[model samples]
Target: MRIQVFAILKDFFKKEFELNAKLYTIADLRTHLSLLNPNATPVLNRCRFAVQDEFVTDEYTLTGNEHIVIIPPSSGG
Candidate 1:
C-alpha cells in the first residue's frame, strides 16, 4: 500500500512511501508502522488515517491497493 504522511510523521517517514505487507486493517497498519519505527509510536497513536479522502476508523479494512494518508495532529495560534 502507498502511504502519505504529514506533519511530524513526515519527519520519521518521508512524505510518501510504500508497504507491501499484508496489512488487514488500519489498526494493523498502525501496529506495523510502530514496529518499524518505535520512536514514532507516540505520534502514530494520535494520528488519523484516511483513505480516498475520507477519514477511516481503526477497524477500516485494507485491500492493499488503496492510497493511505497519515495525518498527525496540528496546532496553530
Candidate 2:
C-alpha cells in the first residue's frame, strides 16, 4: 500500500514516500512508519490516516488503497 505523507510529515520524511508493508490496520502502519522514520514518531501519534478519502481510526483495517493519506497535526484558533 502507498502511504501519502503530508504537511509537516513531508518535512520529517524529507519528501513523501511509500512502503510495501504487509500492514493490516492503521496502527500497524504507524508502527512500521515509526521504525522507518523515527524522527517523525514523536508527532506521528497526533497524525491522521485516510483511505479512499475517508478518515479512519487506528483499528481500521487496510483492505485496499492506491494511496493512503497521512495528515499531520493542524493548529488554528
Candidate 3:
C-alpha cells in the first residue's frame, strides 16, 4: 500500500512510502506502522486516515492498493 504522511509524521517517513504487508483494516495498518517506527506511535494514534479524499475509521477495510494519507493534528495562529 502507498502511504502519504503529513506534519510531524513527514519527519519520520519523509512524505511518502510503500508497505508490502497484508493489512486488512485501518487499525491493522496503524499497528504495522507503529511496529515499523515505534517512535511514531503516539503521533500515529492521533492521526486521521483518508482514502480517496474521504476520512476513514479504524474499522475501514483496505484492498491493499489504495493510496492512504495519514494526517496529524495541526495548530496554527
Candidate 4:
C-alpha cells in the first residue's frame, strides 16, 4: 500500500514521500506514522483522509490497489 503526503504534511514528513507499506486500516497507518514523527499525530487526526480521491474515515480499511492521500485543512484568502 502507498500513502501520499500533502500540504504541511509534506513538511512534517520531510518530503512528499510514498510509503510502501502494508497497513490494513487508517488507524494502523497512524501507528506507523507516529513512529516516524510525533508531530504527525494531531495533523493526522484532523486531516481529510482519502483513498483514490474519495474521503474516508479513520476506520476505513485499505485495499492494496488504492492510493491514499492525507490532506490537512487549509485556510487562506
Pick by TM-score: which candidate is best? 1
For all candidates in order, the CA lDDT equals 0.94, 0.81, 0.93, 0.78
| 63 Cα displacement, candidate 4 (Å) | 2.2
Point out where model 3 deviates above 4 Å. Answer: none
- 38-63 in candidate 3: lDDT tens per residue? 99999999999999999999999999
Q: How do the predictions measure up, each by TM-score?
A: 0.95, 0.83, 0.94, 0.78
Best prediction by lDDT = 1
Instruction: Please identify model 1 stretches exceeding 4 Å from their true place.
Output: none
Give one digit per residue, the lDDT tens place, for model 1 in 1-77: 99999878877898999899999999999999999999999999999999999999999999999999998987767
Q: Residue 11 in candidate 4 has what lDDT?
A: 73
TM-score of model 1 relative to the true fold?
0.95
Model 2 lDDT on a 0 to 1 scale? 0.81
Please report the TM-score between candidate 3 and the true structure.
0.94
Q: What is the overall TM-score of model 2 with all chains considered together?
A: 0.83
Question: For candidate 4, lDDT tens digit of each residue in 1-77?
Answer: 66687888887884445677788888888788977888888887788778777888888987766677887887768
Q: What is the C-alpha RMSD of each candidate to the true structure, in Å?
A: 0.9, 1.8, 1.0, 1.9
Ranked by TM-score, top first: 1, 3, 2, 4
